[model samples]
Target chain A: MHNIKIVLIQTFHPGNIGAAARAMKNMGLSNLVLVNPVDFPSDEATSRAGQATDVLENATVVSSLEEAVQDCQLVIGTSARDRTITLPALTSQQCGEKLVAEQQSGKVAVIFGRERMGLHNSDLKQCHFQLNIDANPEYPVLNISQAIQIVCYEVFKAGQKQYEPQIEAYPLNDDLNRFYDHLESSLTGSGFIKPSHPGQAIEHLRALFKRARPTSKELQILRGMLSSFDKE
Target chain B: MHNIKIVLIQTFHPGNIGAAARAMKNMGLSNLVLVNPVDFPSDEATSRAGQATDVLENATVVSSLEEAVQDCQLVIGTSARDRTITLPALTSQQCGEKLVAEQQSGKVAVIFGRERMGLHNSDLKQCHFQLNIDANPEYPVLNISQAIQIVCYEVFKAGQKQYEPQIEAYPLNDDLNRFYDHLESSLTGSGFIKPSHPGQAIEHLRALFKRARPTSKELQILRGMLSSFDKE
Candidate 1:
């Protein structure tokens, strides 16, 4: 069994929770923890889960975030896009990759916020990093369950791709995703991203780096480069 | 003005067709050709296209694949990661980058097979090369519009990135997938796939590479290794 747990904090929809369970099942992940879900074991959720009822039945439901992730060695919070907080962040893939690496050492948990508002700054502070998916700015919001599905899928994929006998080169996609988010965030914070228009400049930046698909190590160097920007 | 004209062949879902149009629009490509789409001027498609209806309204609806690419200098077919035929293939990004490059010299057309069966072998034969997206083998299929979005998005990203003239050495995700696929195929052909299990061997292979996250040059070497098996 994998040493990773997926936690949804204050989830608003029963169907989404169910769908999240289904997504987890499809990815071979069983440890699901829900924090104050709107409904549980509902007919809508069970039916939407299709064959994933087992996941829902076995899921641990808690009332608060602290209780859900207390034992986790690594905790990651999932957000829609940009948040007001200056917290360290990782893309969904990064979060997944990190979880896998951490799994080798200890248990890891990924935290997802509510549908409408997402994770609160207070909630994010509890996490090792915030998770963001690279989505179109015009429509930055993703359905809570869909976001969960993508993140869970990436994590599951990253975990499977972990073959130890052969030392494959480069960071996994999850690690690369993390580095990209850090680069983007650091760049934006450093004012390298000019406001030429509403979203065009950022779009151009994304276009540039996404093509590069920087490795985690490369990303670490980019972060170091950005950190040195403060000295200049 | 990129040389790629994305042709949706007999797309059944109007919303998907519309989404495909939106995807192409976001990627900065305008040339779209539809072949016998189930519904056009559809409220769902138009509504889904959001601001991209102009692409749909201006899209050329052709009678056949031949008519769609007759005047093109290069034709590429898109398929998910599955080997139902024996054909030389490129990963989606490779096809996208090559097509973009080819467009600098001549016209290129990318044909998307029907949603259900994908490009028929005969349809695939019409193309200069077949392109496959690296997705989870169990659910390797992607929605037609999602497929279009990813491919066109990569193409647009590549075009913008190429202009920067940077020495960034990052390998693309697609390149990694091709090498992985080649290894999987060879393993299966060699009877390394576990008996009475449909996906055990391939799943293990996917897990192995997913962790490694091979670089472009490294992937090339791995593919070269697989080619040696073919020669034997």
Candidate 2:
């Protein structure tokens, strides 16, 4: 999440740059470096950025991809097309995981190529590995912004997974069973489940509750509801 | 793949429609059904579609979710928010796998809701399950097109899994059904489940087996064990 820069090499559209910034911001990523963008500080870029002008305002503009990514310890070049060279190609997910793992060591850069031509083989040579997004084989090209959104999403997900909060334990089987018993009697009293045909109704109710795997608190609430229903 | 349909309900932006079409095409999916799109055939949509005009051109326009998915056997709704009623929630990956497995049985529809307001409670009721995309918790509000890209990518990946060598096949629904039937009858015959009150016992066993998701070979072994129990 920190010390990670997104480098756009030879970007042709100001709108894409803005959209890329917006995408990065959506994933809680802020650092952006533009290499030889056709236009900077344009109205179109700002308008597309919507409320994410801070990212656009803070973006660093550089002359070349090398200059933009020089500080990065890990450089990943994104390519839509397959190349003749046998460089290790990683999916967007794999790239994100690798970036998160290596981010603590130093700065990491995910470099996106130009709109039409993408990154040249020479530019790709600077990368340790190529990141290839698995897209529809029929029309595999993704908008630059769309690609950024996906890659940033992966990185964000990886970081989030590392800090995922532990969930409370599910209710024990005995608690669930007791809740079910209370529910059955309440429903039968309410005429929702006829005494003679309660077996099928109770089974379906059990199935529904089992699928939910409610927490201990939720089970208590459900039992309370049944008691209220019984009183009614 | 042939019978899968992407249903967009009340899409607000024409540009998002175009982007979604591009995303679908990028993943080798073309069946697009729009339910009450704000604007179609707009210049912005076409422009965003880039080379994916075929998907946009051949897209079907429907009035309601019922109409769009009436013929489909499996309907999956995508929801960013958790609901009060617990539906069987599947991750994008799991949704893809289930869709692929059931595609041969009938048409499968993956429905996306509007930009600002997602599908209503009634709309969700029509779905067999819900697909929740893992996104940045800070900004989980993904652009509609970005969600489409992630989902289509998952489906494409699941399709690719069939050709991926050495992975044992998961038991198909039909195979699981046969195994469940055998299990129930054997349990009844073995006195584990009393014949008169077998409903709840069979339902619990079914739930347990479904959660286990035994592979094809494992199903066969279970059926063999049931046969042995029947003999005893």
Candidate 3:
């Protein structure tokens, strides 16, 4: 099984946190990261966790989404609502397969947003891809824990390793973010993206790089090229 | 899409029923049938259903599994436990594909058992095959509604219909049950199976017939043969 982490952001109900823990543990996933949860160590969460309270006890609480998935090589955001800016979208099954294949290299994080609003545009921008659980067109808003269950179930299915293939290790989210920062500064310094009117160019660049998923060595080479541009 | 029915047999939790309804609606499956559910029209179930109250409102409540699936051509039972009397087992994906392909003929019922105990052996006997949702071997017991969600999701995925063959209509569960009764009594009358020592003969016969899945016309022909033996 892959070392998969379940990240819940700004969760309102502690019960959902507990239920999500149970869902993760039900699929052999242990790591649970919470970003700005409303309540922790609540009776409701503990009670809802049933026999899987250990998952809650050991869960990491972080202040931001970056901290939650900083060390992860692959970050996937679950979105219930359609966004104007399209990220590379994959069904839950595809996400699972990709996550499993990628897990051979490093850690992977599947992030879920708030109970009511789901993942914000800013949060989704940090993800390599968005996962949409193919739900009813009429009532697409699935419960957070239920969504967790679906994703975890898919991962567990893929964990059987029937489609296992060794793939190249992608850089961690932290490395990717750093590269994005370098790329942005280099673009501004090179007068490619005017500081005064960058427009949506940076956003488009981020999406393009996310899709490309440059490896660590590739990122280093790109950074060296940016350094050459900076010196010029 | 297949005309799929989600059946909950002897369900103890009204909230689960409501959640199951929401799960079904989330997957574009509306038909809900309850076989002796402990509570219906309860606040918990309605609250859990969220925006899918129409599913609950239109759900069919029945006294027995026979009544619940009598009109259905394909009856599949979901089981977590492996039984000594082995029935053809299919993962949720295979079951989904088969159900979707079989949907061209008639109604299909995917029955879920009680919350704590799951389906009784007698209940499993009624199904043509068993559907198992792959989960953690350490904790394979998924919540009732969660199981419903997984199965419904697979069916929804299979609903895309890559394999749409128009198969001949098979007899309903009611007709099949009636034929089994007729065959049993006729066997006793013909001295083939004595009422005193029937043993597992009827069960073996049931498994045989379930696999054979005789069509309505074939059932009528078999019934006629039994009637002739009765006259002799």
Q: Which candidate gets the maximum DockQ versus the true structure?
A: 2
Better of 1 and 2 by DockQ: 2
Q: What is the C-alpha lDDT profile of model 1 across B91-182, one tens digit per residue? A: 76587688778898888988888878888877877788878765544555555665676577557645754232543254777776666677
Candidate 3 residue lDDT tens string, B49-104: 98899999999889999888888888899998998876899999998888888888
Docking class of 2: incorrect
All models: lDDT?
Answer: 0.66, 0.77, 0.82
Q: Sorted by TM-score, highest first, which candidate order results? A: 3, 2, 1
Q: Residue-wise lDDT of candidate 1 within A3-53, one digit each (tens)?
A: 788898877778678767766776667788988888776997886675678
Off by over 4 Å in 1: A1-71, A78-80, A91-96, A107-123, A135-232, B1-6, B18-32, B47-59, B71-74, B81-84, B92-110, B149-232
What value does DockQ give for candidate 2? 0.18
**Candidate 3 TM-score versus the reference:** 0.81
Model 2 bad stretches (over 4 Å): A162-209, A212-232, B82-88, B163-232
Chain A vs native chain A, TM-score per candidate: 0.68, 0.83, 0.95
Report the C-alpha lDDT of model 3 over A1-232, residue by residue, as the tens digit.
Answer: 5368899999998978888888888888888999999999799999777678999999999999988888888899999887765577799999989888877778888999998899999999779889989887789988888899899989998888666566555778888888889878866665556778876656755664665666675676556545544554
Candidate 2 chain A minimal-lDDT segment of 10 residues: A223-232
CAPRI class assigned to model 1: incorrect
Q: In candidate 2, which residue pairs get closer than 3 Å at backbone N, Cα or C atoms, i.e. clash?
A: A136-B26, A136-B27
Residue B92 miss distance in model 1 (angstroms)? 4.5
